[model samples]
Target: MTVNVLVPSSLSREAEDKREATRKLGYVARAATIFRADRLIVYPDRDGETGRFDDGFVSTVLRYAATPPYLRNEAWGMRDELEYVGVLPPLRAVSQTGSESNGSGSTRQGIVTEVGPEGRVRVNCGLQHPISLNTPPSMEVAEGERVTVRISSRRPVRAKLVDGPLPGLSVERTDLSTALGREDAGVCIASSRHGAELTVGRLETLAGRVDRDGMTVAFGAPERGLPEILGIEASDVVAAYDAADVDDRVDVEPTDLGFDLWLNTVPNQGSKVVRTEEALFATLAPLSLQE
Candidate 1:
């Protein structure tokens, strides 16, 4: 097999472009005074609330802002309290790998509660909030597949696979009825400009939201009081073979409204094209700002 390599020009251009994008993002967020150069950047929030310099806004913009499954940490999507939502007590979700949790007398095998939008399925052996999987095992459980779920307090109870026979871990089932209750991926309208999702590579790479539900984000919205305002545009992505990183160099694609971004630095681990605009923006808040 033959493999093509990245030319020096391409590599340098990508590096410089990435650097400029990140720098611009920092200036827009931290700079007390806005400048003409910023008009071209993809500011996560347009409310003109300017957050901080050494803060997370800058990182979020230049990095993962749209990626999925990660927590939203904002209040806009926090629909209700843990109790009001009628969640069963934290039941431990165990996997067939003997991965049982303690205090988890929560490990109970039960019928699926209900499956909702996307790949979400809700099982109720009487538990509150879904016991999120650190790596949600494949949702191979059939509607009637005997399964065991481990319950845990202080955290969402996880459901494990038991008595059922299946393949690998993936929630993609044409028979939507296979899994329990599930919610559609949450998206923050505020961060939509960076595209539907941003890949930060690690959990700590991005800032945590004040209220993490499932979807919806605040960006710089909390500073203003309209925590969950709507009316943002979203774009469909062409998934590229690569992803951009904090310092990745790569190519840019244009979309009808928002543009597409691609990164090649993290070779092979390459990802599909991502939807982004302006390539970068200043998310930095002034160093004096508090969290």
Candidate 2:
């Protein structure tokens, strides 16, 4: 099932400096990657943003964190792709691909350097040098196109082209409505302290829904929660679904941000506040347990 994690562009509002901001964003990326989230979306929160924190900087650091170290230079080679900040850390995620049965070959992403006669093409698959592989007869590849390669062995370099999308954390910048409105977005959940408490039975039901529909979990900024970010009152969000009339439900969602549910993942909290990165880990931990 597809899983999308949403964080506000003002996520680094609490950071003391760019270096600290980069480090904090590293934890966010790490949390997403660890939870196996397909997409990490940064939504607009300009009002809540700090003067020192830059949305572009946040995206740059997140993109770098998502990319594998070996492919960083190639995938983000263009100078315009990212403005160099130099302080972003290498946030490497542990692979979920454990030693399992069936011996399915490992897959690696490669960039097509050149296309030759008889469908032969040169690919740079994070190796010491580029390797030439034949494209599937049905598939027509071109130069500068990204391709997936299935590697059966590394020593002898036995590999083949696998016609599919490249695998990794994808970073994006967009608005909340646009993100939730995507066709791939199934169940949209907004996390908030004022939301409904998530219990065992509730989680199971949500997991089943996630398994069927895919999910988009949205997180708020440090000081400004989603209600504030969306220009609404906390009480309105808490009682959004409490309205008796179906027609009146529109009032609850003024921004037309279609969220299936607003959830309080951490029910009994001792602390007065939860940081954005802390909230990400806390919320995704239970969701990951779902089917």
Q: What is the lDDT, from 0 to 100, of the residue 7 in candidate 1?
A: 7
For model 2 the local lDDT of residue 47 reads: 91
Error of 1 at 163 (Å): 17
User: Which residue runs does candidate 2 get wrong by more than 4 Å?
Assistant: 77-103, 113-119, 136-145, 241-257
Write candidate 1's Cα lDDT for 1-291 as tens digits: 110010000111121343443444333222311211111122223333232222233334322221111122321144221112121111111221134424554344444444555554554333444332221455554343334555554354345534432211111111111111123222122232233334444222222221132221122222121122223322222232123232233222232322122222122323342112111122222111123
Q: List the residue pairs that clash in candidate 2.
A: none
Q: Write the per-residue lDDT of candidate 2 for residues 66-179, one digit (tens) a residue.
A: 776766677677654244435555555543133421135877667888899988999988767899898997788988887888877767788889888777778999988999
TM-score list, all predictions = 0.20, 0.83
Candidate topping lDDT: 2
